[model samples]
Target: MDLSYTERERAFRDELREWLAANPPGERPQGEEADYAWRRDWQRRLHEGGWAGVHWPVEYGGRGASLMETAIFFEELGRARAPLPANVLGLLLGGPTLMVWGTEEQKDRYLPPILSAQEIWCQGFSEPDAGSDLAALKTRARRDGDGWVVSGQKVWTSGAQFSKWCMLVARTDPDVPKHKGLTYFLMDMEQEAVQVRPLVQITGEADFNELFVEEARIPDENVIGGVGNGWKVALTTLMNERAGLGFFLQVRLRQLLDELVEQAAASGALDDPRVADRLGDLHVRTEILRLTAYRGLSAIEQYGQPGPEGSLVKWLWSDTNQMLTQLAADVVGPEALTAGRPWAYELLRARGNSIEGGTTEILKNIVAERVLGLPRAR
Candidate 1:
């Protein structure tokens, strides 16, 4: 596939690059609330500039960008070091999935706020009992008079405290098979039945939360796709979880590696032959990742889906990011681990890279069974 950008695509990139250069994001604040507010404002600015929903259908106030241009948007956002928009879950996963499964009325009601960042969204798919094996989730939603009453616990939910809605999946019918008995709901987060408790990670941030949903009431109109078809609807959200975000994270890895190289050169760490060799290896791997990702993007656009041949680059990007951060500690020494420093925070945060999104072991099993076409164990 030709990796070269067309003239129009190049113009798109240049325009965004210029805008970002002129309006760089200010230094993030100290507290979580402050940081979140800053990101929300940044997203507002992106929307005003006609850049936030570049790929959403134009009829829904998007630019209607092609798939490649959408990829360019995330890559440029990452290269600019701008934090993702605070309504990211809504923009990337929620809105897109709604477009796929929601009725016309649902789209009209939800898509506008999503583009404007008026309503933040969070995903409530991963229960404490079902992280990797989502099908094993026990969250239950029983039918009510004109709606449903849901009760469960969801862990590792980001932005729940700030969200107005949740893309929630619950067991609507336990009699049928686990996957078939599920239903998707656009749950209102402002209800008293919902609670969000922050979880502080090693990075000294509470970016994730535990959601205790106790008898939350959702109207039948909030039902997405249909009852008993949530497994399929949720699949749409899961597929989008990594699409553009993979490109952003890969660019972040590349940026961190570049910084490491510059720091090493400045401090004369390059004198060590072993250190130099390792850096070279990392650089090669970064380039390979970039190439493979673009190739995967091409495959995804040409075909409706990225086939088995197209590797899930997020898995590799996660591994590489951890390694890159560790190397920074070695090369930069004690100073790298000094609290409050960018390198220090990055090193701490990298610890969860392998576990978050999906674990390496589980991802390996998926590849073995799905991509390699290996038989599952009896």
Candidate 2:
């Protein structure tokens, strides 16, 4: 199969590149507050330029672009070194889930705000005891009149404090099997009983939080799919998550490696064969990831969604990110011991790539069973 972009695709890439050059992001901000403001403004600019919601249908305030075009957009954004839109949950997961399963009124109400950056969203999927084993989540949502009352805790909820809403999953029936009794809802974060407590990371930043829901009420209309079909609704969002992989990772890895190479050369560490070999390995791995991402994009263009092959890309990316950060620490030597240094912070942050979204072990099992058709380990 031919892997080259068409003439129109090349023109599209050039157009995005020119737009980004004219509207580059300003200086990096210090805290989450500034970061959110910067990203919101950036997203608004993209929306105004007709660059946001490239994958959504035209009826929903998008450009009605094909999957290849969407991939081209991501590629150009990475090439421009642009920061991802701050409301990633909305663009990547929530919007798509709403598109597929939400009622017409829900989609009409939510998708426009998401595209415009007027509403930020967070994912409330992971619970205290349900990280990789998502089906084991214990958060409860019981029916109450025309709405559901939610009462439970969600841990590691990224960007919860600033979000206006959450794409939440909760167990509606405990007696049934783990996957069969859950429901998904679009939760409003402004309710009286909902509380967000920041969880500080090793970098001394609190991007993630623990959400406490004490009788948080969601209207029945907030349900994404039919009752007791949350697992299926969640799969839709998870599929979107898996499909959007490699863009951020590719951007981050490229920037970090460039900085590491410069630092190593200036510090005379590049002369070491061990360091050189490690950097070479990282470069090769990154190239493979790039190609894998392109192939996945190709599949999405042809099939309207990516296949399970995305698991390979996700697994490789998490492992490579960890390895490269460790190599950076080695190159920095004693400087790595300094807390809050870029290299040290990067190493600490890399720890989460393996665990977040889905754990490495879980992803491996997916590839083994789904891709390789391997038998269960019993």
Candidate 3:
């Protein structure tokens, strides 16, 4: 696999780097609301500069960037330490999923707001009982007059409080099999029927929310793919979820590793063979994740599907991040373990990395069955 960037690709990276240097997203505010507003305004700057939807088609108000260029865009964002737009679910998962399955009117109405951050979006796939086995979701939406009334509970919804729309999957046909009976809806989150309560994590922050949706009404026009085809449409969103953010995440991991290495060097821990060996192993593993992510991107761009590397990268990233944070605790000492410290927060947050997006165990199962051609574990 040729990993070298071409002249044009290098030029693209340079231009993006220049833009980020000029228009950096300054310090984030203290409160959650202020921080969200700060990111919203940053997204507005990206939209104005034609950088919001870098991977989107030019006809759809994006740059029509190549796959490599898209990776570079994310890399630069991480390198500059810029926060992702507050409407990340919209830009990454919702808009792309809509582009694949949305009608002309749907695209016209939804896509522009997503790019501009005028409307935030969130995912409503996971419930209290159905996360790993997403097809087992119990949330139901009954057909009403020219619409549907949805009622259920969703957990770990990242931006539900701020989102204007939710890419929701609910059971619309109970008689059929679980996987076949689902329907995808663009559920409106602003109504009285939808309630959001923050889930305070171990980090003492509510980065996620539990959505208690009661009789939430959705218009017929808001059905994403079709009735009983929600599973397929939701699969599209899930695939995008695992694939699109890999680059940004990998870069962030690299940054953490760099910081840890700097700390180790300052503390003179790297002189020990054990410390050096572990650090070396992490560096190699991190590079492997980066390379594997690029290979997966190439496979999708060329073959229209991902290889095993896609699953492997996420698994490696989560494991590596957890390791990095733990190593920081050792090298950076007590400060890293203290409450409210950035390292402490990262250490706690890394625990959920293995579970979010997809779990390590589930990914291994996918790799075993799909990639290794092994028999399914019954």
Best by TM-score: 3
TM agreement with the true structure for every prediction: 0.97, 0.96, 0.98
Task: Give lDDT tens digits, candidate 3, residues 171-276.
Answer: 9999999999999999988999999999999888999999998999999999999999999999888877865578899999999899888888988998878889
Evaluate all candidate structures by whole-model CA lDDT and list the values in order: 0.89, 0.86, 0.91
Error of 2 at 6 (Å): 1.1
Tell me model 3's lDDT, rounded to 2 decimals: 0.91
- Tell me the spans in candidate 2 whose CA falls farther than 4 Å from its real position: 303-308
Single out the weakest 10-residue window by summed lDDT for candidate 3. Answer: 238-247
- Which residue pairs clash within candidate 2? none
Model 2 C-alpha lDDT per residue in residues 1-378, reported as the tens digit of each score: 987778888888888888888998777688789888888888999999998788788998888777777777876777677778877789888998998999899998999989988999999999989988899999899999999999999999888988999999999999999999999998999988899999998777887999999999999999889789999999999888855536666767878888898989999999999889999999899888878888877877788766666567878888989998999878988788597688888898998888887888988888888878999857
Q: CA lDDT of 77 in candidate 3?
A: 93
Model 3 bad stretches (over 4 Å): none
Per-residue accuracy of model 1 over 130-198 as CA lDDT, tens digit each: 988899889899999999999999989999999999999999999998899999999999999999999
Better of 2 and 3 by TM-score: 3
